[model samples]
Target: MLNASNPSADTGITPARRTTMLAVLMMIYTVNFVDRTILATLGQAIKLDLLITDAQLGLLQGLAFAAFYTTLGIPLARLSERVNRVSLIAICLAVWSGMTALCGAAQNFVQLFLCRIGVGIGEAGCSPPAHSLISDMYAPRKRATALAIYSFGIPLGTMVGAVSGGWLVEHFNWRVALVVVGLPGIALALVFRLLAREPVRGAMDAAATTVATEAPPSIRETIAHLFGNRAFLHITIGATLVGFVGYGTGTFAYAYFIRMFHMGYAELGLVYGLVGGLSAGLGTLLGGWMSDWAGKRRRSWYALLPAIGLLIAAPTYIVAFTRGEWITAMWWMLLPGLFHYAYIGPTLGVMHNLALPRMRATATALFFVVVNLVGLGIGPYATGALIDYAANRRFSASGLGDFATQCPGGVAAPGAADSLQSACTGAMAQGTQDGIVIMLLVFLWAALHYLIAARHMGWLKREAVASPAPARQPG
Candidate 1:
């Protein structure tokens, strides 16, 4: 057994092994999201089948999953700080994958919601441990790029989920699609178990490579350390806000296209997979590369790049939503989809820099707590509630008879004087569109926070120059 006081550092991993490890991890992440996001494409069908409201759907997509996912992350991350991270990741993969398959058998809303919760429990185990391992494998200069490559799984998963799940749904049904996406991860878990070798904690940190792994930080110690860093706190907030709007709008985007443009599942999948996925994936990679490139000149550019990207994203998103035509809207949507993802690499890169080597996983968990609970937990649910509220208000003003009884989809706006079908259609389209539009503008708020973080980072860099720290990477 490895001694607690003299832990072994990972040594002699070949270039091939490093590349293989990264590839496998990325594949696992892709599978992770494939299960997580397939539900997004299935919304229109699920709504019709269950006769549920948007608010309830929002709960399924957001709070039900995010609550447990975020809440469980800290303890799991704390465990990872000591345990074999490879084994931990494998177990998590199986748990979430199995739960995702179980989602297919759900006959009702409650059953499906419970299954989603289970999947969340599994997914929470993924990124924190993986981030810690990757940081150990790569030096400071290359860490951001590596993490960004890992992040490609997100957009890649979105694309695959949208396409494959959508294709399955178009050909067969949503339930079948759910089972298909969920089962593969179980096998992939075994593959990762066989292949990945855990690295020494802090091996990639300058000069810290020689030190043995220290005792894991306590939760209080971890939190205190994180909160003490102003730049990390601000960047965390910016990431949270990004997730809020990003997840909120994403949860309902397919539904919007369905209601407004009458696009079918296959077409929606095509647009999201080909356009949104590729653009977002490329943008994530570009952000990491650019963060490293510009950050070489001035370290503060890490946060500065994200600020500029979010500002650009905010306006383009508004333009995308407000467009009347779907083709025109998709063209506009492409830009935001690409640029909006700029935060992932830098935000995470900064957090790793801020925390101690032993605290990387814990710090990652904390980041997720904010992003998942505050952002994912509330963003989609709040937006859904907004749609519900706006639609009801519109329906009430229209003086329509009970909307639930008359409308096919049973959504109505109070202010519209149209017939039942017209009322439902108009209300659904207008309410969802407006709710998303409002959420899109929140990017401006996130951008402001990133700017604040950049200022704090600048000051920190100056202090470090005055007295250098081992953790500080060379510019």
Candidate 2:
């Protein structure tokens, strides 16, 4: 067994090897988000081509992908505890990539939706095992920074998806864009399989007594233990609400630009991609580094940092969304993510730190189940539904006939009267603007939960330090 005090003494992980593995994992995660986010980046084109409503688009973005993704995460995470995580990650990467490629071939709404479900199913195996692997490699003190580096994949992948997806859709059709982004991951999977090696389970835990030689707790036990803790419960709730707002806004951000500003697909993608990547990436790194730095002194900093970030992000987002010009709006966009994404590193870090090494993957899977179900599952759908409601109301108030009958896909029928077209255009823009602003408000509520979690974190920390050894529980 490796010494807990000096993990590097026995583990064969040289600095070079460790860096390589983290980079490989980060790239794999990047591809994961690329596949997941391409649909959203290409959403406007997909909506126009399929003649679908915002709600249908939301179903495709949120529930279709999240349904199986959230469902299969736990079982796959459980399997990770007993199997080779590197192999599992490689397999999942290939499956999701293949499924993403198939999406290009989908001819209609139903077909595309099914293809998205496949993508979700494959992606379900990704982060939990990866998180387990990461915790094994980094000690508790460094876990947040390491995980934040890993989490950097979120913005990086989104950037690649938005930038590449936009340019491809502008040059070719949306089908070609999807295919182009999807096919590359197969080769990446092969590369990851060859390059990545699984770290010994629990190698970095502070106490050997809590390491993976002990049998992992049963699913029931794990769930009960996680939810029984007030800190974890509140963190989970706060993260869920944040996810809800993030997904809801992300799903329609491109649409908002196109409808309100008439921005071209390529320009919009490039601008949004840069803004998101730079700002969110900086925010993620800052969150991790700051939390780890501040947390060394006070554990509650982990929760407090996220709360403060969210409070700042909410109002800044509102300012950005309310801007008249796209350029002006995007300028405001850069500020919120810097504060908004600070939660991710600290949250994941805290979750892993709170659990025994054996329970890390399950904890992550469970965390995702709640976060994805309500956040990814309902957020976009709710926003889209609200958009539809608001647009219809605004259109009707203009003395126009039913909005749905007069405007299909938020555009007036071809050769329709100028006044009708104007009403449709203005209503669509206003509705999208309203929906995004409403979603931003949820960030305030999410911030409050983090504050509550902060109050409980000190107690949780004492409990953890008091019990260094694992207690036997019946299976």
Candidate 3:
């Protein structure tokens, strides 16, 4: 057993082993996101085939998946506090991967919705435990960068999903796309289980801390402790708002390109994959590296960096959405993600820093609940509803009887007149564009919250210094 008294003793894990572990964890996360995002890449095809409304698609993308994913996260996280986190992650990996493959078989909205829920339930077990493990391996000063590297999985997976899902859907079908992406994860899960070694919890904390000896806090206690901190509350709120805009816009971006630009699946997929991947990957890393670099001088930089990034992202996003041409829009798209994603790493780092070592997983679970529920659950659905409403209003103005009946899946019915088809296409393109612009405006609100959180930086600094004290035992 590693001595708790020595902060330098990190369970005899060599630097190479640590790198390999982080790499595997990141790969697992990449797989997690690829399964989650493949649906988005194939959304237009699925919409056309199922003849579902935008709202239905939103539910499939957001609420259906997020409902169980967020709800189950706390319990799974609590379980991680007791069991082997690597084993838990492996099981979840298999479950979600299998569910994702099953999604390829769904012929209707309800069936696909259920499969997405299964994917969510499995994904719920991923990040909280992973965060705890990473925190234990890396010291406080390096946690943000490490977590940000882990978060690189988000963009990496998105890139792979877009590129691969697009090609698969084009060459075969959406069903094949899902199955192809989903099956590989089972093998990856087995590899993760065999390779990852559990680290001693809190081994990197100050010598006075008792996290290795103390029992994990109850859910109620963890919630109470986290909510009691003003900075955590603000960070959660800011992150939730950002997630709202990000998920909402992201869910429909490919659909918008298809409707408005008339780009084929494979072509648009490659473009979106490269653009989103590079920008977001850079942004995630910069957020962590910049925060850590600036945070050394002033702890408030953590919150301030995200605020600054969001403020810049909002206007650029507006410009990107408003562009009439796809080429110009893609160019503008690159700028915003570089700034918009800066919040992810810093927000996670601060939340972990504020909690006791044993409370870390629970804290992550709680934070995810709020962020994913509101952001992932409602963001896409709300945006889709907005697009539907706007499209219907425009269609009605053109003397169309009802948008839904006249235009199923945002296109005119078969054998419809060219005039009606043209109207349907115009209404959909404009509606989607308008909805995305409105959602982008939410970034400003999110940035404001981050600015407010910066005001409580002293509180975060104090918590870090005071973390060496023993945690209160559950009664």
Candidate 4:
């Protein structure tokens, strides 16, 4: 549907304008993640205050938001290409920002869940357009670096979210914290609308010389084209697997610390927040830089970079799990966090390179669907369910079998083992620790996917030429 070779009507763009726009886009990205991460940081407090289960928390953090985010991203991205990207992004930001603040006002589980869904819907506009925009802003050679700078939002935003959410939640209630963290994005929405201009679409195409194509490929066609791409398929699957592990780790790490080592919110905010954030940020940037540098020689390194990083990361995370000392664990976790997130920027660049200009946003959205559905939607939920199962197992182990027994409706009906149930409940904290260990194994499994992808990287890149669209310039 999208002919990469097709050109739009713009002359070459100045580097200065590109740089300025990218900075603004990056700032907006930072806000996007900051708002998103804040909820994760305050998860425990929210759980306690709202009297919900970890499974429910997982739902809120994972599927409830990701469902809309992953689903709507593609259509919206398609819309961005057809309309003004800046306007689309601005409106989405405002909606999501308002939704974030609404989260603060939620008095019950249902309300909060609804608000999270709104947040997801709003955030759906982000990556597709941003990826598309960045592609317009930079040439392929420099795209990874620009993307890495944009991806820096993950770490920095995580840091800000963690520290800010932790501090606010620790001092006040989760609601107030939500209000404080969410409101800034609303202001950013206005700033973005006023200051940011959509760059000429497809302006950076290296080969095509035409003015423009009037319509984007149909959604079905975009999918068919992208899915037909072996590299896109492999990387999409690979990235999804990695996301499963990465997001799972992020969701549970703080809670695991609390259960195993008895760390509180403040400590988590301070130690994991600051340390993990810095490490992740550094990793994100480093990974991008390395991919761009290495990719120049071996185009396959775009995929290889993540493969190598994940391989190294798996063992370090294993060690991190066993560490009893908080300081020791924190130190070990820093680099691991950085390396774990390094896959983001390069992976995005790869997606941009592989897709035709018209479908860039839609391509990104499609990737988001896979990545978020598998990774964000299921990761935390699976881990939480595992934790819940572990809790049940712990209860049974303590001779609370009858008390923990499930009835016809999957409800836990009090049985003859109430005494044992009480005993196991007394040790619920330990059960949670064991569950976290089990969850860590998912990451190990995810790492293997990256290796598999690396082996096929050469074939993937070569396949991009199969449907090579004529290169185009910005309109």
* Ranking of candidates on lDDT, top first: 2, 3, 1, 4
Better of 3 and 4 by TM-score: 3
lDDT of 1 by residue, 1-475 (tens): 0012222334346668879999999999999878877778898788788778888888888888899999999999999998988999999999999998899898888999999999999999999999998877876666678899999899999889999977889999989999989999999999999988877677656446444546777889888777666666787788999999988888888888888898889888888677889889989999988886666667777888889999999899889888999999988878987789988887777667656778888889988998989788898888888887776666666677555555545444355445766877777788888889889889999989888877866733633111112222347
* Minimal lDDT window, size 10, model 4: 403-412
Worst 10 residues of 3 by lDDT: 463-472
lDDT per residue as tens, model 2, 220-288: 988877777777788899999999999988999888999999998999999999999999999999999
User: Clash pairs of candidate 3?
Assistant: none
RMSD of each: 4.7, 3.5, 3.6, 5.4
**Model 4 per-residue lDDT tens digits across residues 194-294:** 87777766777744433246467778877887766555566677788787767766776776676567677776887787898788888998888887777
Candidate 3 — what's its lDDT? 0.87
Measured by TM-score, how close is model 3 to the native structure? 0.95
lDDT of 4 at 319: 81
Q: Please report, in order, the local distance difference test score of every candidate based on alpha carbons.
A: 0.81, 0.88, 0.87, 0.74
lDDT of 3 by residue, 28-55 (tens): 9999989987878999999999999888
Query: How far is 68's C-alpha from truth in model 1 (Å)?
Result: 1.0
Return the TM-score for each candidate structure: 0.92, 0.95, 0.95, 0.88
